[model samples]
Target: MKILVYNLKMNLDDTIYDLKKVTSKKIGVSERDFASFKIVKESIDARKKPHINIVYSVMVETDRKIRIPSKGDIRVLEDVLKKPFVYGSIKIRERPVVIGSGPAGLFASLILAQNGYKPLLLERGECVEKRTQIVNSFWAGGKLDEETNVQFGEGGAGTFSDGKLTTRINDKRSEMVLEEFYKSGAPEEILYKAKPHIGTDVLKKVVCNMRKRIIDLGGEVRFNAKVTDFLIKDGKIEGVKVNNYEEIHSQVVVLAIGHSARDTFEVLYNRGVKFVQKPFSIGVRIEHPQELINYAMYGDAAKHPRLGAADYQIFKKFSKRTVYSFCMCPGGVVVGAASEPETVLTNGMSEFARDRENANSALVVSVGPEDFENSHPLAGVEFQRRWERLAFQCGGRNYAAPVQRLGDFINGRVTRKLGSVKPSYTGKTEFSDLNYCLPPYVTDLLKKSIAFFDAKINGFGIEDAVLTGVETRTSSPVRILRDDNLEALDIRGLYPAGEGAGYAGGIVSAAVDGIRIAEKIMETYSNESL
Candidate 1:
């Protein structure tokens, strides 16, 4: 039997030996009998400022069952069992088709291929190698490739972001997802750290390795194959037409497109796939000096090498809207994330070292279905495009994003020039009023929230702090409706799988959703049918 223990605490300076010795004494075993243990989870308790501590949850292999202590910071950890996949009798005439090479599509394809169901994975943009070059060109003031930018690529939108592995969902598959990432060249710390992040630099290599492994497992991955049309016969999926010409047949289709696939969404909507308008957030990217954030989060201990750069999250509710921070990237730069031409949007990214000059986050306000001009499912998409277009025009009608100083924006005045803190946006950025981009109410809420957040963390609303225009792609604007079987309501073989389908948010959750969909497909079909 394996005994799992929780809430093992140690000082920040303590070593693994200290943890083992403490665990042995607490579990009422000699050091020799304790043998060894693995850290299942670890987190830093920095709430007490200078006096920080490292907390752990560990599992030890043992032959005897251990008793839970009556009092102390220890308890038996619960085991999470995954839903077993039971093969069914349905005949799968062809290999499964997974659209989009994001976490969801890749993971679903990986599982299917590993189980003898070779899957075809298609990505609209180029592979990571080409995609990285194309994105770098855009960032370096070259022409933007509308189809192969940050938002639509091999690693999905996450390829250019912080690559945060944290998810709010408590599903057991998260562990599986993390383990897979670790195997694919992600740092081993991700398996145990609380708020683990791979960083944009490391995630690129990790996803590339994941793709290679999928191919090694007999799965096929094709890039630059955008699904332009779906072939449906009597409410069942027959195949998908890619790049407007080539049609690939498959019995099952996993729609795992990322959030910025506006054209694909329209194609799906026009094909009569059921969709519902979903609430999504939109606002501006706010940036400040990384040192300011570190000082605020760690005080005088901000310079400690062990702590690294600091990040923060703040939320506030006003009248009809709730404003909060999203994708807080410490020591990061704001990047251009527009998938469509003549539009400007911003996202944040950081490298593994996180040693950039600025820290940025999406300080956004939530907007729901009611905020849309109409009840049509695509209304939110149109609404998002409106602000994006306005931001484009505001930024001199180029791919550059319009930026303003925090104080100037709050004061209802246009920013004529930048101050101490220069904008770190990848594409061009010009000093301008952000009011030309966002809704009036959203601007008002952001102004109030900045002050609210400033109280929580000093220097958050500093006069020279930069605010970039329009971060509309927070999540999917419409949810492709799916039933309990994880298939589209009216379409039999269409599985609406990830963020683009409004079923997941970040990398880890999307991967879990993909695993669940793959398991469901496995539970409903068997290879014998082929």
Candidate 2:
């Protein structure tokens, strides 16, 4: 008999000498009755503070029949396996093309290649190997490559982020996404942890491995090949032109371009692709001491060796706006994410170890179409650009990020001296009034949110906490309208997927969206011939 167990708790210092014995004891059975034991999920329960417990859900196989207590956490194992994908019979003459190399595009192409679709994946930036070098040089104050900075790269903007895999969407495809990541150089812990993260350092290798697998399966990947134009005949995508030349013909095109592709968005809008302004958040990156956050979260167990760095998410609701903490990196640094020249923005990234001294997250407020000057579909883009340009100017127009102390920002005064916490931004930073770069309404709400957050996290609003300006790319400001079939509303064979299309929000969700899109394409066209 196979049995599943839940809510098994152990103290921080407790060590299991024999796992089979533990399971037998928990379920009121003998060790000899156990056939196999496996942990299904594990998480730290710090809600009790000083007395932290490790909670686990495990699956066990028993050699003999056992009577489970009717009210206990044990139950009969009834796992439902996912159904296999079925390919369609309609044959096509040309292979499918996937735009961008982010999580969505990569996974979408992987699905297509595995099923013999032989997709052509295109990226606007250099490959990961060279993209890493360029990003490092830019961090070291070298020239920024507008074509391939942190935003536009082989792995997309997510390559330089904290690489969090947590998402709010409840879909079965999510498990498939995690399995793929694990098979492609990601840590094993990601398979079962409550909140899994690959980190930027490890994620780069994972992405590269996935790309290689797609190629080995007979798919093609091209870097530094920006799609300049989309060929459409009577609202059906026929192909795409690369770099203002080199036309690649394909009947089906997946637009998985990431969120930072402003120029591509403009071209698509001009070409009459349906678009709608979407609500997104914008604000500055807040930095605080990692130790401070740990103490607040873990109390007396802050320094326990078993416990790693701590992370948090807090949000407050207002009458007309909502302020929240986003992309919280426990032990991470702020990074420059500028895809265009003369613009400045901030993002957060952490390594696998997460051993940095300070933690950072985006503290932003929500903005909608009503906030824009006009009802134009691209108004949000213009709104973001306006503040980004102002932030650039405030940072001395040299790629430096504008920063202010939390107290100074609250009091509406210019910060003069450094505090206990220092800014961990990768590029140059300038001390300036963040208010000047942000809208007056946003600044007002942010000031109020600090106190509300400080009450919950203890030192969240400490005087020394650094606030870096401006983080506008919380999500795509423009959502490319799509039909129930996941195709562009009017453009047949033009499928929009991932963050750039406003379909997904994070790495996992975007990858899941990509998988769904690939499945839809397979269902419509047969891969036996092309």
Candidate 3:
């Protein structure tokens, strides 16, 4: 018999044995009666901070017949077993081509390869191993590798980010994705932790393992093979041109080019592919001492051994727009996430232990189609580029990021010197007026919202807290229009999937979307499609 219990609470000092004892008492059974037990979910109940508790949901399996408590939180476990996928009967002649090895493309190709559909995965950047070296060199004041830097790489932008796996979408495939991560060198805790994350350190290994598994299963992954052009014939995808020199023919193509693939978006738009300007956020990355953050969230019990680093999420509604914290990384550093030259974008990343000195998050404001006067589909792309370039100029035309003091930004004055909270940007940085890069409207709203957020999380708007300029790649600026079948509206066999196509946000949702697309292809086509 399998049983599940929710809302099981344990004190901060409780042990694993205490959890088993609680489970046995709740089910009116002896401790020895339990055969196996696993925590289905675990979350921190830090409402009172110092007296924090761990709330858990556990799945118990035992041979003994246990009494079901007549409470709402305890009951028989529901069947969350994934439904087996049924493949279509259509036959195909050529292998499918997946462009961009981000989470979306990786999962999509993994699914196809698992089902005997050999897929050719192409990434414009090098593998994670080589890509890491390139990114480090760039961070160390070396020339940025245009193709293999933080934004365009083997694992996509998320490779250099916090590697957060949390998403709001409630999908059964999410569990599958997490399980796969666990199987591919990720910590098993990610399978059951309430807010699971692999972090950049562990995530690199997991990504490499996933790639090896895909290749071992007969999928071919090629690095530095950028898809420059699509071979479209009468509204159907025929093949793709790589780096303007080589072409690979295929009836099916998965475009998971990521949110920073500006050039690819332009090429597709120029090729007459339909697109629409989408709303995205722009803002600066703010950093505070990790100890300050831990105290803010955990109070007197800050830095408790089991608690690790603390994180916060803040959202405020302004008259013209809403401000929110994006990609909040606890005990992390701000990274230079630029794909093109002469621009700077900020993102946050942490290691598996999250033992860094600072916490940072993107304080961004939402911008819609109305914000940019241009009605062109790619106008959002240009809007992002314009601000990015301005930020580049503000930072002395070098790779250094423009930064300001939170207090100075709110006071509408230029920052002149440093404070106790030093900036954690990986690349070089310069003190500058962030107002020079961001629009007046955005800066004004950020000032107001920072004040508001400070009330919620102490030290959020402190004078010494550092703010790094221009985090523009919050998401894709254009949506590659697709139909219910997940294919481009006018182009058959051309699937526009993932962030670059404006279909998903972050690593988990992108991977889930990728799995969904792959399933759709499997359900609609087979060997007979040829």
Candidate 4:
């Protein structure tokens, strides 16, 4: 019960040698002491090499004889309690259903299953491993699989993304999400890194492990089971209609369909669900050699084995409009993420090993109400489609993403040659005018942002840094409205809980919101005696 903070370098193996120095200090150990109980929370710092600091939390216990618990005893206790599943209860109907196997739904299903609720999960896309195979096929030979692509799938769009775990949330549930991820096959190092990421390679296994646990705990996961309609009666959701045919009944439904669920949005809107257009970002995936970024961040230290490849995020305010780096993947490659037949979307992904030859990032501009020509939720989708169409055209009608050299883009002149940094896109690169793909204003803003961001990171605005076209799926452009209690504002059982709901930004916050929504459902049932 004594919580302690131990900031020790991560590689400490000799606990006795290390702790002896701390606990070796003796107090009066005569019969005068009757099991004196006190806990000390001391600050400790560990090292990677000599000066690099790695910190940890440790709990200690001491007795009256001033006798310290043997390191083995402490380790045993810590190990025993470390994975303890607290008795957090929610008396829902024996089974609830979760839509979308993204991080939000996955974590919610895990907790609900652990807490004795046999939740059912539905995912529109294929499993992560299968989805990876399909996505790579498209990346390799330009074959697009609409159902199993990066945007839709067991792991959601985050699977193909940088897997950025950094969130703006400072909540206990967020910490729990990180801890659970570490437990469910994510690298342990992600638990402490300042900007933690579970590279696309590891995220596949991590998601699969979470799915296994859900199944082991009596939950069911149905992949490629698209929920086409929310079956509501008396203005309360009764269940979801899958694939427009089969109906699965459930009193509670967690909709984490993710930002890219455009088809689902259309289906729900027709089913009487209300939504509104919202702001999201639009831009292109820019690919550069990993060495370029490594050189820029570390300079001569770029050759240091410890640093690996570097990633960066830069931003600029252009006349009240903001242009920023959205997803930066180190040692990553630009993957073709197109779902529709004639559209192309670009996303960045790094392997768990992160040993790829290229580095990539999304330099995006915010698209908002101004982009909406008329008042329609799907208007934003149309807007996205238009740009995607142009991007596809920019690529010479192939799956190769449209590419524009920075020197051509910013200098208002097209270049026909390559420079120090090479393009890593498997697709073809065309040095064409970006205006054909992006809005004139958007491309102009981007040109200004490049010069502005140059001061922050070198080699950023270089002539050779490649700009691949149309990274439009920054986030959902429509928010399925939800009330303060997390349920849909108009529909009681319809809980819009994650990125698609406009309630969360990235993986951690989305997962945390999912847990909150699940807990809220449990609370509702508890209050109603359901």
Candidate 5:
């Protein structure tokens, strides 16, 4: 087999010219060679203005070496016959319970159901479609659905988010997740784009379709089934208490609780689960025109139909700390994702069509104990609480987000009136200074970052650009220790897995961790650990 790599340009007629070359280059080739051409893998460089590249391998009719290549990095097709390291089947019998129907739980249950394990899936929130309705009601009428809002619902926080599949991790399972999303009815374009997003509108349908498949395969998903307490007998997990009301029995339970389950963390801690505080990020969602980001990324190719809107991930080293964008949404809307009653928090979401008013992203900075006084496991929760409380007061005691203009934020003043741009938030937004919510250090650093961004992308720091208050729930602020057996540190059968457990960041990493923990359960605790 011969493998080839092609450098892709982010320009119009880029791929078309490549296809033309392919046709011209294989004039005398047999039909078998033409059929053998396939793009097995593609990736973009981890650099500014990165190029899209493809990897493939070819095999002639006379070749006899069919054995899988290993022990080194090679072309993707060279390992076609190899066993999938993630996601085919686990070959187990004991049905497991998965708490929270977010990405972690959904992927885990999907694989388990395919492997003949009827997973009992419990969700604290409503399904995505229903959850969206509840969310809209809260935004429109200020009537909040405490149980099924943006954070606690069927798809977890990501369900209400931009449906961004981008992550910093370079694990191989990332490709598997992207492929699985496509198979579950996401747009096929997500497979090849430099910055792919399923968007909130499309993600709802994808999640419902996936849940239907799980049910068809004997898996059970119980909505409004919030886990309130853990049942531990003889120092091992027996079941869980739901809604502080119903007790269910199960031996193997996967803790796929999304990061918004702060109450669950406190419950687990009081119930003898060991944990330690970890540093996380907190900041505001920065909004700019979609055309600004596209021009920054594509240069003159900004108007290219094939390219669409471009995305940027600007990172900087600030006094031994790093600051960057976390959930960049293009052609997106700033959403009110406040799960709490009075506290105002904001996030960004786009549509599959990406036909929205404004573009937004989390322009967050790293927060450490230097800001929070205590090293307690719940310190992160407190840090988030302080800002959310301030934002609550700033947002007129309702769940309205405290918004500021970039010009006003940099000038250390409050914005008085709206300019040419209108905020995308459905909830009311008051023009105010954001210094009250963010720490002095954070605001100072943000000023510098906005300037850097303006220099990088023209009109990035325009006066009309909106800055939504306090996107604090970037990730878990504590690590629930787990040993190689995938059980909680020194605990018998309790598996603290996924993003809420502080072992993963995004959907891909969380799903990979879930699979790894499930495999550990199958290998060590199965009735017959084959």
Candidate 6:
């Protein structure tokens, strides 16, 4: 019988040399009682501050009957094996096309390829290797490759992020996504950690390995292949026109274009694909000293090596809007994440070690269709562009981001000089009043939210903290309408998946949505037909 144990607590300084011995002792059994033990879940219990404890849920294989605790933490381990996916009988004439090589496209292609369906994965930007070099050059004062910057690459915008895999979703496919990532060079700890993240340094290798596996499984990947237009016949996707020249015909198309693909969204809207304006957030990247954040989160236990770096998520509600901290990167830097020319946006990223001197996050206010100037589906895009252009102008139209000190920003004054916390933006930064770019409501809420957040995490509103302008791309501005079968509404054979489709948020959810889309496609079309 396999017994599941929960709430097994250990001190940070305790050495976990043997799992079997530990499990047996916790369950009041001898070491020879359990045949094997596996950690089901691991999390840190730091609510008590300096007395932090490592909590574990373990599954133990034991033949002997053990006394189960009445604390409701232990129960019988139910091992339910999932049934295999049964392929459909409908025949497919051409290979299924997966647009964009981000998490959604990659996972969708992986699923199709593993089922013997050769999928053509298309990406507008370069692969991870070249994309990294291109992004580095752009950060180092070189020209930004509009087609292949931080947003359009093989791994999507997430490639240059902190690679956080945590999501507010509960799906079995989430495990599948994590498993695939683990198989593709991610650290093993990501499999069990409470909040797992594959830093930018390690994520590149993982994405590259996943791409290679897709290719090895009879899938074709093409870089710099931008889908300029959709070839439709009778409101059904017949193919896609690449770069406005080459047309690749395929009945089935997975529209996994990421959130930053504004042009693609416009093209789809013009092609009569149904869309609706959706809500997204916009704000600035706020930076603070890493030590400050650590001391705030860990209290007196800030120097514990077990707690590598501390991260935080905070939010507050207002009368008209809700302000929150999104994409908190511990010991990370603010980055220039511009895809369009002459526009400046800020994002945050961290390496695997997370040993940087500063921490940052997006302090944003919520915006919806009501906030947009018009009711048009693309209104949010225009709303974002307006502020991005304003930010560009504020920074002298030189691609430099506008930055301000927290004190000056709260006081409604332009920061002429930086303070204790320096800006870690990869690109150039110019001191400017953030009020010149952001909406009045947003700036007002941000000012108030900082004070509220400072109450939660001490020093959050430190005078020296840096605020980098214009983080508009928080999520998709529009949602491509889809039917019950995950196909585009009123358009057969067109599956709109991932963040671009507005069906998911973050990396894990996006990948899970992609897997679900692939499953729908497989259930509709037979792999043997290919």
Q: Which regions of candidate 5 are displaced past 4 Å? A: 1-4, 8-11, 14-20, 23-32, 40-76, 80-94, 525-530
Misplaced by over 4 Å in model 1 are 62-67, 76-84
Give the clash count for each candidate: 0, 0, 10, 5, 0, 0
Report the C-alpha lDDT of model 5 over 446-473, residue by residue, as the tens digit.
Answer: 8888778778777887888888898898
Report model 1's TM-score to 2 decimal places. Answer: 0.97
> 1-530, model 1: which lDDT tens digit per residue?
46667788788678999988888877876657654588989987778887777898887765545677787756665677867767867989998999999999989988988898889999999999999999999988888898899988898999999999999999989999999999999999999999899899999999999999989988899999999999988999999999999989987999999888888888988998999999999999999999999988888778877789999999998888899999999999999988788989999999988899999999999999998999998999999999999999989987888999998998878898788898999888877889879999899899878777999998998999999988999999989999999999989999999898999999999999999999899988887754
Worst 10 residues of 3 by lDDT: 521-530
Pull out the clashing pairs in model 4: 7-44, 7-45, 8-46, 9-46, 9-47
lDDT of each: 0.90, 0.92, 0.90, 0.76, 0.76, 0.92
Model 4: per-residue Cα lDDT over 163-214, one tens digit each: 8898888897988998899999897767656678888878888999999999
TM-score (all chains, Cα) for each model: 0.97, 0.98, 0.98, 0.84, 0.89, 0.98
- Order of models, best TM-score first: 6, 3, 2, 1, 5, 4
Q: For candidate 2, lDDT tens digit of each residue in 1-530? A: 78998888877776654445567788776766667777778789988898898877888887677787889898988767868877887887799999999999999999999989999999999999999999999988999898888988788899999999998999989999999999999998888788899899999999999999999999999999999999998989999999998999988999999888889999999899999999999999999999999998999899898789999999999999999999999899999988788899999999988999999999999999999889999899999999999999999999999999999999988899979999999999999999999999999999988888999999998999999999999999989999988999899999999999999999999999999999999999999897
- List where candidate 4 sits over 4 angstroms from the true fold: 1-94, 413-415, 426-428, 526-530
Candidate 1's displacement at residue 8, Å, is 2.8
lDDT of 3 by residue, 1-530 (tens): 88887899898789989999998888887878778889999999889988888899998887887667576787886667777877787666688999999999999999998888888999999999999999999999999788999988899999998889899999989999999899899998898889999899999999999999999988999999999999999999999999999999988899999988889988998888999999999999999999999998899888679899998889999776999999999989999988899988889999988999999999999998998868999999899999999989989999899999988877767788988988989989987899889888888888878778989998888898999999999999999999999999999989999998999999999999999889888887794432
**What is the C-alpha local distance difference test score of candidate 1?**
0.90
Residue pairs of candidate 1 with colliding backbone atoms = none
The alpha-carbon deviation from the true structure for residue 272 of candidate 3, after best TM-score superposition, in angstroms, is 1.9
